[model samples]
Target: MAEFLSLAEAVRRTLRDGDTVAFEGFTHLIPHAAAHETIRQGIKDLALIRMTPDIIYDQMIGMGLARKVVFSYAGNPGVGLLRRMRDAIENAYPRAIDTVEHSHSAMAQAYEAGAAGLPLAVFRGYKGADLPKVNPDIRFVTCPFTGEQLAAVPAHRPDVTVIHAQKASRKGDVLIEGIIGVQKEAALAAKRVLVTVEEVVPDFRGLHPNLCILPHWTIDAIAVVPGGAHPSYTHGYYARDNKAYLEWDGISADREAFAAWMRDNVLTVGPEIFAERVKGL
Candidate 1:
């Protein structure tokens, strides 16, 4: 049931202002192209969700597209801080964005709970952690069988979940291999799923059957975007661009530099350029 479309069309059709969008990827296979397309299309007021929000979310926050962010970690990967996000939070530069923080375990459990159609995720966490003092969402529930207490948080059911995968069969089934993180659960938790892949093949018959595969029926749209996860790497295809990550600290340190960089790089380019950018990676 997945419709194969261009990245621009897929993003425009599935993403909108005020939507809760989760660009789920771990250290690898980050959906940079889809996020770039969303930025190019000027979608705003998004509630962004991720377990680890790296450069992509920083770019979105820098562009002033996000009104809220739900995440466990925010950084530039190996780099120091997400300067743009810090600016928005501390100084309200482009706009004041709200933040809801959680532990890595809680986020993963929340996504799993959503995929399971549960209202909340319950787990043993936050024991002696000060996170509960600040994050009111971290509450406690008593076990029925035992007198033990468990931590609970609302499940994350995003409006759209976008991810970059290594390949997709012509039938629309997606293949993601390397550090998948919560991509699967996030996709299942969302109302709509949009995927970008490095290539589209006739079928995945020769690949390992036990590999992580999302059936065609689960996705709404797919875009063949080679190098779509640029700077983040695509496992068997290329390595992560560590230089870019290092440079981001300087590029995003100032508001003007960040805006100019986005204007020149993101706003001026189309998704097609991603394929070219990955050359020699």
Candidate 2:
């Protein structure tokens, strides 16, 4: 049986002070809202893993909620540079330990290995690359039968995975559009999986069987909240909150503005307050 919890309760229950959390979403869609709630609750020393670290990760790092971030890339999508993340990389006390730069496919492969209880997965994307410099954990191995070298990427089994989706069944079958391999891999790789959905349907039969990305067994908790993505967006539903992203981008560029925004929006405010602030945008 799948448990149904409110977003706040789910986040409060699953997150610890220091844990590795993989977030679902691309550059600007379906960010894990409950993960942000956890960050705002003062969870410290979090290691956030993502394909690309964008506004949410940047803000968390700036506010001192993140200790490390493992990602393939970190930048403002379609915008300029991610000023806050760049500054933190260059400055900030107790600098962040960033990891190897690999494609999303490679990261998903690593998570799949972790989910399968494997030590490592070897491939050929690191022979002459600089990823080893960023993450020395990767090892090169020789295939005895094939007599070829392969890059050994260790599994990234996270403590938890927080994913936002379009819809879910009452029984916890997640329905998401488009590519879901990464989300599925993250759910399987994590010890616990929490999903925030825009809405809840009655049963799995209502959804197209082919669009069923995650089965009920993999999900630990489900929270139904419309507009759960906030700054992000749901595919085939709405566009991203461009105005909100612009505000975040502006605040992220300047220290004082960013500090004020964090104190006003993140540290002092709860989920309700944050939602209210994003109402117009």
Candidate 3:
């Protein structure tokens, strides 16, 4: 059964140093607050997994909280390269991080395979791509049936998978609307699941169908955290903070400035302030 808990307690109880963690949510509901909490708690050496690596993963890598990153495309979305990520990989400033590159389909299939309790994700990808030259995990397998070449990668079964959603019922069921990505699959594949939601209502009365709903049994803990997905939009609750993303390029350019900004804005602050982001609620 899912228990209602504070974000601090949830992160403390669910995550640990050197664990494989996946803070998943493609474009929307990016779980920014949870990532900040992970940094504040000082969790280190995590193997972070996600399809599209964005600002949150960049922050974790910048803080040296991650040892390895497994993803397809990595960037600041519409912006340029993730400066801190680039620094870690190129300059090895904070630390030299390892990377496992894959295509979008490969990662998505890996999540599905993990959820299905499979050891490998076999798919058709990486044809004429140079990723295989760098990542040995991208192996070639011949299908016994058709003899067609298929790529195989290890399943991404994270120790814990964290995601942000719009609402949760008091009964502990979570509701996710707008852009649904690999959240449900990741949660199912993980050993433990942590969800942060904007609000907890008595019942999901007016919510539309076709939305991703995780029953209480599937969730370990649920945190009521409005604006938890800052800098990323949470569908009807808020809009993406374009200025923040743009400003991050400058703030994270230098190591000292990045540490200073995180110390002042993120470390000093808590999830309570995030509620202010969704006014008139």
Candidate 4:
């Protein structure tokens, strides 16, 4: 059964040191509040997984919380590179983070395989791509019928998967709309699931059946966190904070500045402040 809990308590109970954690969102509904809570709690040595890792992952890696990163692409989204991630890989300033690279299609397949309880994701990818030459995990299997070789990679089964959503029912079923990603598969593949939502409604009775709904049984905890996905937008609640994204380039470029900004902003405030942060947007 899903339990309604505070963001702090939910993170504390679900995540542990050296856990494999995935914060899944494409461009929308990124779990920024839960990520901040994890940082504030000082969880360490995480193996973070994502298909497209944006600013939130950069923040976590810069803090030296990640020991390994499994992903297809890493960037600041519309901006340029993720400076912190580049530093970790190139300079190893914070620490040397082991990386496993993949194509977008391969990663999606891996998550689907994990959700289906499969050991490997075999798909048609990496054809003429150089990733297989570098990443030993990228192997090939012979198709029994066609004899055509298919790419194979280990499934991604995270210990805990956290995601932000637009709404949750009182019974704890989560609702996510607009630009859906592999969040559903990631949650199903995880041992534990935590969801932070804009609000909790009475019931989802009248909503369209086709809307994406994660039944209460699938989630372990629900945190009522309005604006939980700040910078990233909820479908109907708020628009994306474009100004914040533009400002982050300068803020994250310098180590001292990043540390100071995080201390003054994220460290000092709780999730409640996020409700106010998105108001002006």
* Model 4 lDDT per residue over 217-239, tens place: 99999999999999889899999
lDDT of 3 by residue, 1-281 (tens): 79999999999999999999989998899998999999999999999999999888888889988889999999988887888999999988689899898889999999999999999999988989999999999999999999999999999899999999999999999999988999999999999999999999998887677778999999998998989998888999888888788988888888899999989878999997777865643
What are the per-residue Cα lDDT tens digits for candidate 2 across 1-281?
Answer: 35788777888887888899887776434554675677677777888888777888787777777777878777777676777777777876335545456766567678888888887877777667776777777778889999888778878899988888877887778888854647777788899898888778887665566774688889888887666677776775555777777777788888898888877766675555435544545
lDDT string, candidate 1, 169-262, tens digits: 9999999997889999999999999999999999998888889999999999999999999989999998898998998999999888888989
Q: Report the Cα lDDT for residue 137, model 1.
A: 92
TM-score for each predicted model, relative to the true structure: 0.99, 0.90, 0.96, 0.99
Which stretch of 10 consecutive residues in model 3 shows the poorest summed lDDT? 272-281
Candidate 1 residue pairs in clash (backbone atoms < 3 Å)? none
TM-score of 4: 0.99
Task: Give the Å shift of residue 59 in candidate 1.
Answer: 1.0
Global lDDT of model 2: 0.75
| RMSD of every prediction | 0.7, 2.4, 1.4, 0.7
Each model's backbone clash number: 0, 0, 0, 0
Clashing pairs in 3: none
Task: After superposing candidate 1 on the true structure, give the runs of residues whose Cα lies further than 4 Å from its correct spot.
Answer: none
